[model samples]
Target: DKYTGQPLHNAVVWLDLRTTELAKELAKEGGQDRFRHVTGLPISTYFSAVKLLWLMRNDPAVAGAIREGRAMFGTIDTWLLWKMSGGHSAGGVHATDVTNASRTMLMDLKSCEWHEQTCKELGIPPEILPEIRSCSEVFG
Candidate 1:
């Protein structure tokens, strides 16, 4: 979705280390221990939240879009699903399976849902988050 009315052609891949500093900041602010306990993952640049934080901090357009409540985020699978179902213009479903959700570092390991507290702490808009779904169910 081009929330900024400007096409965002780039993607911050999982292997991208550009979020390394942001990851460290997150670990310090929220503590690595708590993160592991809730998400069963360490605070690292490998996760989506950290990369998102980096973008929000560095990209003016992205930050503006998010602030305007027009941004959307998802992992590759979620993006693919949205495209397959229908593009944003078609009201595509933004959804993801539990296993894929677990890897995002934004979903609760137990509830398999996006934790509002964590999202607030990270300055991530909950509206941009994808809906959590069962792995076996058809999503959109």
Candidate 2:
């Protein structure tokens, strides 16, 4: 579940090589597909934000966590970085990589940041959103 009270289960974190190959296949099958160009990866519901929403709606603990700000919402990369950085609550480096952010449908494709409108549309709070960053940048 995400810190935003989003429920998540069976979340799949696609490995870099696997994601790349999937994107290539998708591009080959559907020539000039914008998904591959924009995201640099194949689109998959498994790696995205829908599950997070589900968790938020169903899990009471998750809902409380989000409200407290003690929980953080992030993709796999962001979670990893937070854990690696000592998980400090004050400035714990909560963030998400561009590619992972793109899959969420919550991030603006162009700005690479959480979209307020999207959050509202999805019944999510902008407050719990993760900071967006480039895939290569270090979070620590």
Using TM-score as the measure, which candidate wins? 1
Off by over 4 Å in 1: 2-9
Write down the worst ten-residue block by lDDT for model 2. 1-10
Instruction: Put down candidate 1 lDDT per residue, 1-140, tens digits, no spaces.
Output: 43323334377788899888778877787677557877888888888888888888899878877887777788888878877787666777788899988987888888889988878888888888889999889888
Residue 36 accuracy (lDDT) in model 1: 81
Instruction: Compare the candidates by lDDT and give the number of the best one.
Output: 1
What's model 2's lDDT at 97? 79
**Model 2 C-alpha lDDT per residue in residues 20-121, reported as the tens digit of each score:** 443344346455333444444334434354455555666776677767765567776776776566565434577877777887756767778777765674
TM-score of each: 0.90, 0.64
Identify the runs in model 2 with alpha carbons over 4 angstroms from their true place: 1-47
